[model samples]
Target: MHSDGNRKATIARHRVRLAACALLAAAAVLAGCERGSQIGAGESTGGPSGCPAVLAGAQAAVSRAEKKEVFWNGPTTGPAAAPGKTIVYVAQTMTNPGVAGAANGVREAARVIGWNVRVIDGGGTPAGIQAAMSQAVAVRPSGIVVGGFDPDSTSQQVSRADAAGIPLVGWHAVAAPGPSRRPELFTNVTTRVEDVAGISARWIIAHSHGRAGVVVITDASIPFARHKSDLIRKELATCSGVELLAYENIPIPDASSRTPQVIASLLSRFRSRWTHSVAINDLYFADAAAAFRAAGEKGSGPPFNIGAGDGDPSAFQRIDDRLYQAATVPEPLSQQGWQIVDEFNRAFSGRPASGYVAPVHITTAGNSDGATTWDPAGYREAYRRIWGK
Candidate 1:
């Protein structure tokens, strides 16, 4: 009886061991299947799965419009000005490099045309802009140029200028979807905000191979920033595999202090899934890239960053170093400044102001080795010839 019991116990133990091994094999197969499903979920054996058609369409559209230049072919002689006549430029802020560059362009053109020019610093505040506009009207300059000031805040002053028969020209001032409602506004020299956002989105998608999980950093205080953010959201919606993990609107005042925190928080939360960062401009992208490096996240395949406008020098350096920045779409800021002068000249001459679409170009680490901004082909000569400088 004891021998028989031992034999039965040994058989039962073997049976249990065989069952456990089978279960382990089953679990391994199940795990492998799960991984396979994940890998194939948004990709194909042939190529990327999500939004292939959309990607191709975007590429075609960009290709169709790539590097198309617009030049001013109006009368060579700008409106003749009396020796003492003056032009007033209401700068957004002299402190801003881009605004300062525009001011310089205005100054240069005014110098060539023998017109006195005064630039009032708007101090980047509504009150300052209003004050500047009021002061400009008091002086009764030949014309007025505004650099990215809020039109509504200065509407009354704009009305006053119109009543006083002063032509107002804006550079980088008009928001997207604008021919300013204020009839006093003569024209705006700017690129379509949507186009800038769209091109940037396309670059992200293409470079990431159509699988972009993006974090968009926007500045709500700036109308152009909001416009760019909105358009980027719209474009990315059409892309299937692209997910918008966060749409962070960093107020202009807090951007310097808040950017690092924002980037760190988002990286920690979405490090595995996030693949790109799209910022309103290069300034924010630089901050994000620095934060990424500080956090010890190493590798460059996904989570690339890109931006639009101003082409901050630091951003170009980041791209060169291959830290995280991938590309930047630079608006021809200085050239736009010259265009502002040309438009004002046209208005002063009683000719209809020809609003020129500012040109933009995508600069990568590869293409932007020695450059930080986009200058249209022969832009200097073209403007000089037009202004008869």
Candidate 2:
């Protein structure tokens, strides 16, 4: 009787184990089916595929005033420069076209107003930025504009400027989380990064018909790049038919050598599953398109690419040539330069700084036939008028 009872217990335990295994298998199958349903329901407006329509409506709702022509309307009197007053522009790096363009803008505006202006190159390093800031502080310029350098890195120099009654303005230096509220830093002039990401995502979704399998290329080293990447991820989340296969963060230091390998690996892993690629800027996506060509895996149809920030000439050429690059959102660098000087003028004149939002526009093959950057004719005229030039 005891042996029979023991044998029955063993059989009961075996039955329980089998039941558990069956339940596990069923759960796994259900999860996969749910994922597949989301992907296949491309026509459903309530699902991920519905993102394009939502984005379209939102974009259309942008105020007519905001979308209106870019123009300057600051204090008409402008700032009264102190005797022998000079303005200094500290650039993150002259190597970057955007930074260089900004430097030129400062010079142009200063020339119009007849104020002495100087620019210092920071060499794109923390130490270099600190050193440049130190040099500028020692000279005791009327005001200082810093391009693409983190405010925290040069806090000491910024404090010195503040103590000396010189206002400091930052361009592309502050990120989201809040405005430039630091006492030493007056204000930041920058494009709406969130809008740049949102518009680029919307473009991809609309062009791909919402069936986009996207691979995101992000640069974690730069705060603004990460900001753009984060916004892209958030915006794409609303699209049901869009699958995020991967988010690859490539540090700028190793980007030249690592990007190709990273792109090749993504191609190998996802194969033809992915239908689109988005990046922080044209720099990364342009290189990615080249990698696809070199690998001889350039497939025909619909998994195109897009990016944000500087509208590189090479990127425009690629778009015009019908390459994988589809579009780029260009932040008006020269306009920001003019705005930076304008803000400083207001501050010096004891008026509130005019926190200007730089204009951005999408450049594609159709619209950018011969344009590397958006034309600033209207804004330039407006600024000239305000300055009584």
Candidate 3:
């Protein structure tokens, strides 16, 4: 009777152990499926799960970009101003602060350089941009500034300009800044998009301590803007804990109307999970602020925001006030504007492009010192001296 009892007890214990093992296996499979679902929509499996190494590197990079005292290291020697030259600025839209800011710089420089400058607004449409480019080419200006729009979209106009020997310069018009052979730009004026993208992503990583649920906003209509957002997405993926919650595509023209609605939807769906946001341009945050306020989000934010490029005055104000935007990787719009005019001077004198790319900088309220724009020092004087004005 004792042996039969011992055998029955042993069988019962073995069955319980088997049941526990089966339950663990089922949990493991379910967890993997959940991860698989997350990854199907642009999630990353790279980097260490906790991202200790990545977090340290990101913190260091953000430290470098946040410095306030930046000096200009642009071309000090170039052809003196090509005087009396007429240049027309073909704008993507005057409403875009970056474009207008750069245009203002061009006017400032042109006044010193003794050149005539005209602006033709593109209205932020392909047709509108093409019309502007056509008008610019028809006016037969000494040069054409492709301000904040793709040159390829207006290929015929670009080709016409090239054929007519009118030098073309682009501001935020290409992926990389410098001379291009295929699209045929004298040089593109802007910060390196990769640097902009990386630092913005690193800002989020450092700010969040490697754990964040991020939403990336971009305008898919412009090639430069689209490429910038794509780079931002890739950099965000470097930290395994930084989950990309959504990639929103709201065109710049439609942003004012569309962004509020989109932000409402995102808030409803993601709620507390969306811990941070980044946009290719700062204006999205401008549009998003109202929606956030309506939903009772704080003037400060759980979804701390950053703009990847084009640090306009409004963006700086937003950062300084801490009204939803925390930081910006601002292009020296005014400096780049001066650079654009200088590049045209070089082109007119039959010289090669200046090959000067601005260093990336990040602006936050603590570092802003009540400034409304990120206008670095010394570039204006440097360009003036080069132009011998």
Task: Identify the runs in model 3 with alpha carbons over 4 angstroms from their true place.
Answer: 1-49
Q: Which one wins by TM-score: 1 or 3?
A: 3
Candidate 1 has what TM-score? 0.79
Candidates' C-alpha lDDT: 0.70, 0.69, 0.88
C-alpha lDDT (0 to 100) for residue 12 of candidate 1: 100
TM-score of 3: 0.88
What does candidate 2's lDDT look like per residue over 1-389, in tens digits? 99999999999999999999999888765553332232211232122444556645434522221242445433344544423458989987775556777777778877776678989988877888899999998998999987776777788888888789888888777674213766356778777788778877776666555666888887776677788898998888776767899999985545667888898898788765666788876777556666788766442323467766766666777777757677677767767777777777777777777655655567766677566665345666566665566
Q: Which 10 consecutive positions of candidate 2 have the poorest summed lDDT?
A: 36-45
Q: Which 10-residue span in candidate 3 carries the lowest summed lDDT?
A: 35-44
Whose TM-score is greatest here? 3
Model 3 residue 290 distance off true place after TM-score fit, in angstroms: 0.9
Task: Give the residue spans of candidate 2 off by over 4 A.
Answer: 1-85, 176-179, 297-302
What TM-score, over all chains together, does every model reach? 0.79, 0.77, 0.88
Candidate 1 pairs with clashing backbones: 275-303
Instruction: Name the runs in model 1 displaced over 4 angstroms.
Output: 1-47, 61-85, 94-97, 176-179, 298-302, 312-314
Measured by lDDT, the strongest candidate is: 3
